[model samples]
Target: MSSIIHILQTQGGEIWSALGQHISISLISLFIAAIIAIPLAIVLMTHKRIAEVILQITSILQTIPSLALLGILIPMVGIGTVPAIIALVVYAVMPIFQNTYSGLTTIDPDLDEAAEAFGLSRAKKLVKFQIPLAMPMIISGIRIAMVMIIGTATLAALIGAGGLGTYILLGIETNNNALLLIGAILSAVLTLIFSALIKAISKLSLRKMGILFATLIVLFGGFAGYRSIVKPPVNVTIAGKMGSEPEILINMYKELIEEDHPNMKVSLKPNFGGTTFLYKALQSGSIDIYPEFTGTVLQALVKTNQKVSHNPEKTYQVARKLMKKDANMEYLAPMKYQNGYDLAVTQSFAKKYNLKTISDLKKVEHRLHAGFDPDFYQQNDGFPGVKKAYGLDIASAKTMEPSIRYKAIANGKVNLVDGYTTDPEVKEYNLVVLKDDKNHFPPYQGAPLMTEKFAMAHPEVKKTLDKLAGKISESDMQKMNYLVTVKHEKSSKVARDYLEDKGLLK
Candidate 1:
């Protein structure tokens, strides 16, 4: 409980900002959904067949996964809050549309006759009596939509849509359970609060409720107009992979880059899929810059490499050339340290198996259990490609989060974990990192990768990125990783401390 409180206190500013974004996105989506759905439902009511079909279409859209919907919107409309809001609106339309149709169609026949006896026209009957009489049900539909929109808005972070979900994803990536809990609880609370607010609004008399509508208009228009009018100074976006090392590197980059270009506005967005998803995001312009390792770059796409190369520089050159030729992305200078994959085992396990190298472990591979980060598993240069190259396939292989892989191995949940060379937990847990004797693992020299257009377009940004090349040594990166994974230091703080010590920060 104290830990949770600590996480909340430290993240209060971020929380408030996320709340505002959450409300803005959800309300905007709900408003749009109501506009389209309420009218469409009424139109479709006259044609029962079309009404069923329209509802079916909306329901089918709801069936699509939130992430999939977000991804689909990326290539078509681009990323950020636009795609997120569009996806939310798509998801929201169903509840309100369904409720509107049912609410109107279920109205008492006597009400319709009464409206006619009062000399009301068909349209006037709907406007003055039917819709007003069905107000409770329509509001109920909106309540449901609002509740869902608030909860689902968390996925907005995946597409760079800022919300509390950012904290949840960040928490998972950094192995901060307290942060994860706080983010989840807050999201749930927001959903409940909106649902309650809508319910209260529904209970109010129609006259009072109409005034609330005016307030909503002012809030919505002001918020939307403000977002559209206000622009960032430079609008440079920096994306990073999900794990601690990548996050630390990117944050340090952000600090350095911003210091270099004070007038530039910088935003850091972390992708959960690491290189696997990040590279594609770069191609689609979802993100501008991210740190990548040569090893991962070698297998950036599936089936691109038949085998992993042993040579580090060669791997870098090939990756750089391919990225340029294939996607116009430039691989900038690599840092001094190489954070390669270390197929690690607990000290006790190593002692028991006499495991000295990757090949040695391969001998008893059939009997052992292996766990790898999803990023590693997905990369052809990652576990699968490496394993195939080395002729070792542990039948009992499981995908694990990068942050907890070490703990999984230490606690006997997994016999082997695909650990990073820079991970401090490998040393802390007294684990034996098996050597890649066959040189199956490629060099994973850390470097900043950016689209060529962005590089050429922003020379100062490129120069700032280049200045730090080969600066962060193996030891320096390890220290930062240790501080976060073991000492519980925030990645940004660890990065700041490292930069200050290195005299990188002005």
Candidate 2:
């Protein structure tokens, strides 16, 4: 509890910023959902069949898995707040629409007749009678949607939409319980606050409620417009894939770039997402640069069936050449460390299975339950490559998040998991990594990757980043990962210390 308080005390500014983002996005999405759902619900009253159809569609939208929906939307709408809001709106619309429609349609027929007998027009009846009578049901729906939006909005962080989930994801990746607790508790608190606020608003006069909602909408719109117009133009935006390593690397990039050009504004988006998300963001010009691995370039992005070379220089050369030719991206010289993929097991499990090599896994293939990240499970150079190279096909493989896999194996939830060579958890968990005797996995030396166009335009930036080439070694990275993951140090501080230690920073 003291540790959590300390983190809150030290990082209070970041926590507030993230909390503001969480509230902004959630309210914006809920507002939009209400705007669409409420009027449509009112209009559908006379057309019962059409109303049913629309409600069924909302139900279908509600049933679609959130992550899967976000995955589908990324390619179309791109990432960040737009896609996150669209996904939330999709989830939010159903309850609001269903409740509003049900409440309006199911109003006592006697009251409707009374309104008609009083010479009330349709609009007047809705305004003075139907809507007021149905207000409670509508407010209940809004409360439900508001709570759901607050909870679902955390996923916005996955797509670079800033929110409290940043702390949650950071906590999970670095194994920091304090950060995790902060994010979770804050999120829960926000939900309760919004739910109660909606309930309180429900007690207000209709005119007051209208004034309040209108004020909120104007405020939200003005806030969004102000952010876009008021902020300094970002000259460089560097992003990184999920993990402590990427976070450290991007911090290093941001620090170096700013040091080189004092007047330049550089932005860092750490733990943005997986390689594909970052790559697409780069292609769309949403981000300027990110750390890329040589082997991932060859296998995942370029998808070349070229001969896999074990030599670090050879692999980096191939990656650099093809990346420019095929993907229109520049691959800088890689650092000395090879953060390659490897299969790991507990020390006890390895001893029991007598596992010494990738080929050894074949002996216990049927008995093994493999936990691999979604990227590794799907990439040709990951599980599929392992199967083809070693003729070992383990049927019981499950897709797991990168951070959770370490805990999963440690707790005996699974006997095997895929991990990077430089990951500190390999040492912390006392896990033994099997040798890839067949050399199926290629060397994954980290390099600064950016669009060729960006590289051409920002030669100074490229030069600044090139200083990292051949800088970080295997032990250097492992130790840095250890410092962040095990010691719970800030990535920015860790990165700065490394740069100072190596005399890389000006």
Candidate 3:
């Protein structure tokens, strides 16, 4: 109870932002889906036979898994709101389409005869009679779509479109049940409220509904106008990938910049898609700063496998030098910790098999069910490299969301799962991190990657980041992660506590 209270108190700001995003994304997507679905359903209904074929096409879209759809969308559209909105719109089409078709076709033929007798045109008949008669069913469809969209909007955070899912993902990564509960409960509540609001709106008469629609358009237009005319509050925007250590480091930067300057208007954007997404965003100047690892930048960005240094400090120096020389970003001074990837198994699994290292897994490779983060499959030095280096052949390794991977391993869904050395769940779940005895993976020294122009523009912020250099050791990071992931504390609170303890913040 106390833990839950602390989380609410600590993460109140985040909850509010997520709620706004949740509402905006769901509403916008629903609005767009309605525009597409209504006309398509009208056309299909007129053709009769085409309705079944088109509905089936939409059914196929509805059948695609949300994660799979997002995976396809991310690569093609690039990550962020556009892909997420498009996915939601796709999800919503079936409900709206099916309902609108049902409504239009099932309408009384007598009304069409009466309209024809009055010499009314097709458009006038639809506006005056057909649509009005079908109002209840169409509204029901919209209500259902809105409800579904609200729930699905949470998944948008996975692809860097911030929504309520941000808290849930962070909660899962930290192993914090409190955080998870808060996100789940809040999402459910938001869904209910949105459903009720849509239902209430649907009950209004046609003229009233038109008024409501006009009002929404006006409000949205005004907001857009105001945003364009007025400057945004956030001056410096930095993002981080979805993980505990990344969360911690990003919060540390936020705390330092905000607390020191008191009114600097810094915006710390969390819940980036992945390393690849962040790298592209940094390169394209979509984001100004983010925490990235030496080895990840080496393998994912520069493909530095040929001359990658195995040593942590040397790797940081190498990555830093190259990033400055070759990329739009430059590496800041690194944190003290060297958080490399680990192949983890449940403690019981390790004890049962007496497995101590990656090489040991080769003996029982076929027996083990494997799971990893999807990003791992993309990196040159990730799962494939692990497979090649260890000479192990596991027929199928499922790629899952990083947050769920820990639970998946612990629950016996998978014998082996990917983990980071600094991950709190490793300790919290009693997972054994099998050693990379062959040194197949390179060193991953954690550091901030900032847009070089941004760094040059704000030397004060650079100096502030430099203060964090070599301050947090591996043990220190593990303890902080443990507090958030296992103990269910907010990362802000955890970071704040550590910084105060270290006398970095007062």
Candidate 4:
């Protein structure tokens, strides 16, 4: 129960912000879709063959899965709002298109004849009679499209599009039901409000021309103002990771710039995933900067087959060389801490077996229960790699979220679990971190990966990040992780506080 409240208090603002972004993306896409679809509908009414072909084409687009469409668009349009908007618009087109065509075609021919009898031209009949009569159906179609787009907008959070989807994804990732419920409710309410507005607009008589014109003007003006106010500078695009670490880094940078260098305008584009995702974002230029581990970049790009070294400087140098030669990227200065993977066991279980290291576990391997994250089970550096390096195979293994693995081990659900060396829970739970006698895992030296172009353009930014390099020891990293992941503190606030303590921010 306390945990629920903690999640809400910490994540509420993000949930609200995500909701706002989701609504913005959905409505903008719906509006654009209406503009294009309405015209296409009118054209189809007049030209039967073209309308048939177009409707079929749009239907096919509708069949494409939303996430798949977004993925396809990433290479062509890159990430963030543009690709999200495009995918939403494509998804929305068919409904509005079908309804507009139906509404126009279903209108009585006698009404057109009556208009002609009154000396109205074809254009006059379309504008004054056919369009007005078909509006209710068109509006209904729009309402449906808006709801669908709102729901799918949550997926945009995956690509750092910043919408209500952020809450849903975070909730799922952290297993927070309250956050999920709140996000879902907010999306539904927003959809209802938009649908009601559209319905009211459809019901309004054409005689209220002044009111209608004023409303349209106000909406357009509001949108223009919003675009100007929210749009970050054209010069700098800030991209980072989605979780606590990225959030902390983003907040630190924002505060430092705002307080000390207000002249520079920046935008934050956060992508949430494991190290591989952030690395790819940097490599593709979808992100300007992101926090990464030197070992990950080295292994992923340089030599997946090579053994990992504990020497942070050597790892950084190797990663730096690979980035320049292979990825056209740069490895920024390392952080003070190491976030390397650790093999953990509950204190009671560790004491009973007198287990303390990978070698100590060898005798008890067949009797011990193990837990691994799903990705860890599959990755080359995960369980299979551990087994190969240590020659210790546990009696049972279950895959779960990394955050929960510690708790499961603490509670005796599992005797052994994979954990980050610096996780605060190691201290909290009094668990034993078995020494890596064979050094299976590499030194996960925390750092930032940046494009050569960004490095050249913003040398000061590089310098600012470099100052923190090798400053965060493993214990410091673990405490910071605990503050955000376990304590439920806002990542941004925590990051800002840390930077201020270090005199990194004015």
Q: What is the descending lDDT order?
A: 2, 3, 1, 4
Any runs in candidate 4 off by more than 4 Å, and if so which? 1-20, 46-52, 105-136, 170-181, 206-218, 225-236, 255-262, 271-277, 283-286, 302-307, 342-379, 382-419, 423-439, 503-506
Clashing pairs in 3: 174-485
Question: Per-residue lDDT for 1-506 in model 4, tens only?
Answer: 56557766766776666767877788778878988998889877989889999999999999998867876777677778898999999989999999999999999989878888999988888878898989878888898898888888888887778887776655544345666676777888988898888877777776674487568658967986998899766545556654455566666666655565567776666535555555656666787877777766765556545555678788778778877887778777787677777788887888899988988988998888888866467666678878887887779999876656766887778888887776677777888899988887877777777889889988877766666766766666566767876665656778877887877776
Per-residue lDDT of 1-506 in model 2, one digit per residue for the tens? 99798998999999999999999899889999999999999999889999999999999999998877877777778777898999999999999998999889989999989988989999999999888888888998999999899888888888878899999999999999899899999999999998888889989988998899889878888987999999888899889888899999999999999999999998888888888878888888878899999888888888676796988899899889888899899999888889999999999988998999889999999888988988899898899888888888675889877889999999988999999999999999999999989888988999999999999999999999989888898999999999999999999999999999999985
Q: For candidate 3, lDDT tens digit of each residue in 304-392? A: 53578787888888788878777757799888888888898888888988999999998888897888997786687799888888898
Better of 1 and 4 by lDDT: 1
| Arranged by TM-score, best first | 2, 1, 3, 4
Q: Give all TM-scores, in the order shown.
A: 0.90, 0.97, 0.87, 0.77
**Candidate-wise lDDT, in order:** 0.81, 0.90, 0.82, 0.75
Which 10 successive residues of model 4 have the least lDDT summed? 169-178
Model 1 pairs in collision: none
Best by TM-score: 2
Which is the leading candidate under lDDT? 2
* Model 1, backbone clash pairs (residues 3+ apart or across chains), number: 0
Q: Which 10 consecutive positions of candidate 1 have the poorest summed lDDT?
A: 300-309
Task: Give model 1's TM-score versus the native structure.
Answer: 0.90
